[model samples]
Target: EEVYASQPDGFVDPDNPNHVYKLKKALYRLKQALRVWYDMLSSFLLSQDFSKGLQISQNPRGIFINQLKYALESLKKYGFESCDPVDTPMVEKSKLDEDKEGKTIDPSHYHGMIGTLLYLTASRP
Candidate 1:
């Protein structure tokens, strides 16, 4: 991954005043570097028998990695605890319809909902 930085004061070459420096080494703040760090840490955690309880994907083979309390807490934290329950997760009849005339939702709120759902999947084994 490419990383860029501008030369600090007194370090800039006077002949190339408009030039910016390209980073050759992976910095701790870079996104790719952070991902590598996270992978290493997660690998270490898994090696120690710690599961990623908040992960979204489910594993088969009848493993009982329940996160019921975590799911409940997440729902409450996202203000869904008192909301009316749905018999089914989605309505098949509305699958093809686009909400062209419906009120617009905040993008941040929509992302928050997705995040909560992903976390809620931890309870599913």
Candidate 2:
């Protein structure tokens, strides 16, 4: 399937009032493009004898791709490099709650941390 989006700011059509540029590639905003690309790539990989790894969840049909390099770099980036490894990330009784009284950290920093953790969840969840 093909998708089209508005042309760049400098590019305009004088002849066609409602003309839109044809999209030749997949874009992030297109909801189905990711799945389409994933299926296409997966099919090609399977043809080359690459087996799919474990699926992360059943409902969404998400699959996990190993990211040892990313994990290592993330650990280093978050100052967990030299820290001792633990058997579990969180304690069974531990619960995360809103710390309304705690000192507020930078919003960007917190968001970056959340983004990294979100990526980790693809494998760990």
Candidate 3:
């Protein structure tokens, strides 16, 4: 996985003006950079003799591995573990209504909830 970047504004090489510099480290905020980080982490874990869990479903017909325990732990960490369960995880779009004058929710909290849902749904078919 090679990544390249153009030379900085004042640091361009006169001799090779068109040559882009190869990245020696991961750049911040790029999605592919996360893969590099995960690879590094998995390598370190393997070196330390830590076994990775498959987290597969108990059902024989399941295709994807489910990280149920981790998801439950995350929900508990966010104080939502014991909250009332619902047939649907979110509200129906058709039943939605705008509240222009209502108080705004915290951005961080909203992001956390969305992140949790993403993790939970990733393992589903």
Best candidate, lDDT = 3
Q: Cα-based RMSD of the predictions, in order?
A: 14.6, 14.3, 13.6
User: lDDT for each of the candidates?
Assistant: 0.75, 0.74, 0.78
Candidate 1 worst ten-residue window by lDDT: 55-64
lDDT of 1 by residue, 27-71 (tens): 786778888788899999989966566534446854345666666
Task: Give lDDT for model 1.
Answer: 0.75
- Could you say which candidate leads in TM-score? 3
Candidate 1, superposed: residue stretches over 4 Å from native = 1-65, 89-95, 122-125
Q: How do the predictions measure up, each by TM-score?
A: 0.36, 0.36, 0.41
Candidate 3 worst ten-residue window by lDDT: 50-59
Q: Among all windows of ten consecutive residues in candidate 2, which has the lowest summed lDDT?
A: 50-59
Clash count, candidate 1: 0
